[model samples]
Target: MNRILRVKEISELLGLSKSTIWRMRRDGLFPAPLKIGPRAVGWRESDVTDWIKSRDRLQ
Candidate 1:
């Protein structure tokens, strides 16, 4: 089964600040997070992994 990760977890995994991710989402520079609920947002494990790979290719 696929996993989902909250902002804090994603931040830690990426070694980036939560706010930095939030801003990237706002500016449309990163893969947008999923709206899992009315009051909750998260990133799918696949999506996050894909984003990381895409970024890696750019470097």
Candidate 2:
């Protein structure tokens, strides 16, 4: 099963602020988060990992 990552965890993993992540999502530059709860959102682990790999390729 795929794990869901919260904003704090994603921030730590990507070395980016939570606000930046939100902004990226807003601009469609990052994967859209999944609605885990009525008021909570998270990204899938595989999605994040793939995004990291794509970035690595660009560097």
Best by TM-score: 2
- In terms of lDDT, the best-performing candidate is 2
Model 1 C-alpha lDDT per residue in residues 20-49, reported as the tens digit of each score: 999999998778878999999888899999
lDDT of 2 at 12: 98
| Candidate 2 structure lDDT | 0.96
lDDT of 2 at 32: 95
Residue 5 deviation, candidate 2, in Å? 0.3
Model 2, span 23-49: residue lDDT tens? 999999899999999999999999999
TM-score of every candidate: 0.91, 0.95
Candidate 1: the clashing residue pairs are none
User: What's model 1's overall lDDT?
Assistant: 0.90
lDDT, candidate 2, at 37: 93
Clashes of each: 0, 0
